[model samples]
Target: MVTIKDIAARLEVSASTVGRALADDPRISAAMKQKVQEVANDMGYVVNRAARMMRGVSSNLVGLVVPDIRNSFYSTIAHALSKCLESADLQLTLSETDDDRLVELRHIRELTSVNVAGIIIVPTARPHPESVRLLKMTSCIQLLRRHASLGEHWFGIDDTQALFQATRHLVELGHQRIAYIGGTTDLPTGAARLQGFHGAVAGSKAAAHVREELGAPASTDFGRDAIRRLLALRSPPTAVVLGSVQNTQGALEELHASGVSVPETLSVVGFGDELGFRWWGPGLTTISLPVSELATACGLWFIHQLKQKSANPAPYSSVSPPTLVVRGSTRAVEAANASRAPARSRQLAG
Candidate 1:
């Protein structure tokens, strides 16, 4: 347990000078700061974080609160965020809420109590009022999901456009009847995605037949159950658009178990470009979201806010666009086979 005094004695300087240099206090000369820092590093003079915390200073740790990490979507973001923070010599503290409001509240409360530098959260559909209040008191940024109770300090992708492009692609392939599987409208992502799917179907020039199975807590089980319901329909859709990542996984699982041949029986469009998606049957055509880019950008912005000592006067929001990737899991219907070129031609093989 090397202390400031040990570093000061080794450097032939007073403890106060060593402390100021370690804290990067402007009063210390750059050369002296450099010398002190080098010596402190070599001596392993760890900072007294507890003492600083007792003095009301934040720890060099940022907090991240998200839903299940099993979802590639959230896990990807977490990895990106962790890597981004590492460059700043900061550590990330991750917590999961399981989409439960009480669980969400508890995590936020614990994070705030610790005086973390900042917190990044994928807000639940309905956050507890106190959770909202605690976040407002800190430098907080929302990712992917948003609640009205929380301000506009967020980073996310265009959910509506993501779904619209997916749903419309099938329509252009001469598939009139389409089925949509997604989460409920309680969350912004769900609402926007559902809206996009509906928009693409209704706005199409051709008459479109649509069936949707949407409900709460978008999980793999829910996605699988929704596909089962759609498959039971008297006139099953020719194409299916999975609106959430968890739902996409579940839908694919059910589709496989039912012995339904993809593209041949039912063309499928998945939510995220998970690694396994390419290896799935005939390669799954899907929406490609820049999760890493979004997460990194959000982290950098939060770091900027921390430097400014407050959020930008006007709430800031950044929305990234999603790309629709084409693959063999989708093909032109017989009617559209010779009618026109496919909606997209950029093909990726597993």
Candidate 2:
């Protein structure tokens, strides 16, 4: 195996100089660093992660914990994170929690045991105090989610502001009877989104028309069930806003099965632009979550934490606003209910 000493001798530099250059120390000039790197590469010298860990240094491995790896939103962010980590010559270890707190705790423990240099997690619904404390053992960054009491590194979209804007859009389109479908009241994201929905509807003339159904996280089955319940209401909503892309798919399927024409009988808006939306159908009107941007911010934050060596220290946080993408799924209120003919015309025709 090629060793650092071999590279150092080949480059005619002291072993300590080679080490500092390899570490990219400020004391080493750029030209010397480049020369040392070139010799190391030519010699096929690879840093042994085990040796570095034994020396009590960074492992150059990052752990990424996500609620559901199957979800496109999470997968998208994972892809971005992986790419970013790779650029920094680091490796990524991924763990799927399936939105279960117990499973997430286990994953966190495993990552720490491996001496991962840093961790980026999308926490489960409620903040787990034990889990939060455990995270202090390693550099941690929270992504695409937030915790209320447990202050720590975080980066995610402002879901409340996003949902508020979405609701206002429907109201501006004259959609007096608008309903929300997705998320249980227990989850922070769910509760915040609900708050935004109510904030937009409060004191409005159409407040009476606003309804909500707290369901599972962005599942098609949940969407179907929520839609069924909404349609059974005494006065069904003319429009619906979905909390996730997965749920939107289910909602659309149920509506199609019921022979309900979209925008004519019902207009819909969903969160997360997601993949294949354009080719799926007429395309869904949605709030794009800026998944890549959030991932990049999380990766950079994790890197910063790694350098600071401050585990469990709460860092400055930021939230990005959601961007609305208008598409074929949503329409004006009059267009949405055009299927209902005037009572006078029906009586005369009869």
Candidate 3:
């Protein structure tokens, strides 16, 4: 409830002088601004955000909309974005869409209604046209997993190249049967990753390989179910690649439950470098997305756009390529062992 008048009276200055000093107006001398700010801080003065909004000024709050905040991938992005926005003197207003189209549209509209400085969204898999319409109501920067219709200001990782390299790595280990689990073909990232998996398998020097399954939604349940089904297959895959962090975690759990030893029984690769992956029983060999760099780039870009201070033209797109980190979870398959194990129906246990 502290007001500028209270600070002004305490500092023996006029309210207008206090306001200008609080805003750091050039007309206010440095010594005066310092004194006003110190007194205002000590008095716990708070800005009249509603009054500023009424005068056509927005709060220094940016909206970050993501599918699931509990997912480590999105959580890491949020952390990085928070740090970047903090340095720029802006606060993050986070919203979760849960990958639901209606929720996504609602979040965007709500943020716009509040006049958020800008919104950064990792949109749902199949965003409706209404969602796009709602997004146009505010300045928005699309994050990972952008829909084709709303990629005007997008920043994401190269999902296709990442998966392609991962699949190729498994192929190079002399395994002919590989399975990809995670992501529906609805979103661009999902479709691109699936294409990358197929592309690698098709181009590999392996004579013939079987693709067990391509799961959907990139959730823990989907990952767990997909791995179970693939393992139950008669000629099961020798390697499995997960498309998301949640999927990787779920798949790892399934593997452990089924007593499948990574690299020995079935090689495993995952998307996104979760902290647990590095220290798990067998370190995961996986594709690592540049979460921090992507968040920083998106935060800076959105901040620039919100302030209209950048000289660059609009319709910006930034892509961070993924990197594959090799670890203990993958190993070269011996040709003799692969041939001998095709019919040994112990259910892919290492």
Candidate 4:
């Protein structure tokens, strides 16, 4: 491995001068910095980032933790965040927690121990004690799902509002028997979205129409299972609202398997506008998350924190509002379904 000393020897400059030039320190003349960088590049001299981090120098690495990258929503957020941070000359290190508290805690500790500039996390539903301790040693920006215990800066969507609009859209379309399939209340997102769904139902004059089937983890399997249970009911819902993109995909797969035609037989509204949804048999109506905006805000705030260690920016908890996109998947309830009032009553019975 080529060292800074070797580069300095080739350039006829002190090792200290080479270091300053590589760092682009304002004190170094632009011409000299350019010359040293070109020589360093030719010599294949790499900065000893690990050594500099050990000496308490802020690293150019930022850590990003998410539950599942396979989920399109999280994957999109990760991509947006990567682009935003890269523009500022910072690199991103990703850790997938798989929604496990222990794994989350381990990742947090590992990142902080390596002296990453900061971490942006979509924390697990349950709080881990190790998360609290390690977070104190670094800057953290919570995303999407926040564990109430770790009161960090949060950049997320208005989950409640998102669900409320979705549910209300079905209601407006004359969907009296509507079912909600979503994640458990352990996570803030689950809780907020559930609350929103119920709030819309409670406030609606057609309050008796909505059925909720939450408590399952947010996954494709959960979506599939929830749809099965909903359909098994004597008077199945004429419409369904899914809380996440993964859930939507799973639910739609089950619906397809069951031969239930969308819009004609059942209306559906999904969370997060995944690309595949547009080309699906019927274009899916969904709530579009402002992923780019959320990522930009988190990246900027984290970079600012790294620069001003003492600067206490207000506790930011802003939410990017979601947009409800109408498509071919949702339609007004059929006449036969609307007339089965007694069937709806029995369906809700224990």
User: Where does model 4 exceed 4 Å of error?
Assistant: 308-311, 334-350
Candidate 3 lDDT, 1-350, residue by residue in tens: 99998998898889999999977789999999999988988888888877877787767888999988999878888999999999878999889988888988888877877677778889887787977876676677888877668747889888889989998998888878888886778778888888888888885654366564556567888888889898888987888888888888889888877767666678899888888888765788999888988999888877777667554437888889899999988888784356444423334322
- Residue 332, model 2: lDDT of 84
Mind giving the per-residue lDDT tens digits that candidate 2 earns over 39-136? 88888899877777777876778998998887887888889999888877788889998888899989988887768888888888865677888887
Q: lDDT for each of the candidates? A: 0.86, 0.79, 0.81, 0.83
Model 3 lDDT-worst window of ten: 341-350
TM-score of each: 0.91, 0.84, 0.90, 0.92
In lDDT terms, which candidate is top?
1
Ranking by lDDT: 1, 4, 3, 2
| Residue-wise C-alpha lDDT for candidate 4, range 1-350, written one tens digit per residue | 99989988998999999899998899999999999999988988888989998899878889999989998777877888888888789999999999988999999988987889888888887758878778766777889877666675888899999999999998888777889999888778898999888877776655786788775568888899999999899988888999988899899888777766676667889989878887665788999988877888888777776667764566878789999999988877765365434432222100
lDDT of 2: 0.79
A best-first ranking of the candidates according to their TM-score comes to 4, 1, 3, 2
Which residue ranges in model 1 land beyond 4 Å of their true spot?
Answer: 203-208, 335-350
lDDT tens digits by residue: candidate 1, 227-307: 988888897777899998989999988887777767767789999998899898788999999999999999898777777
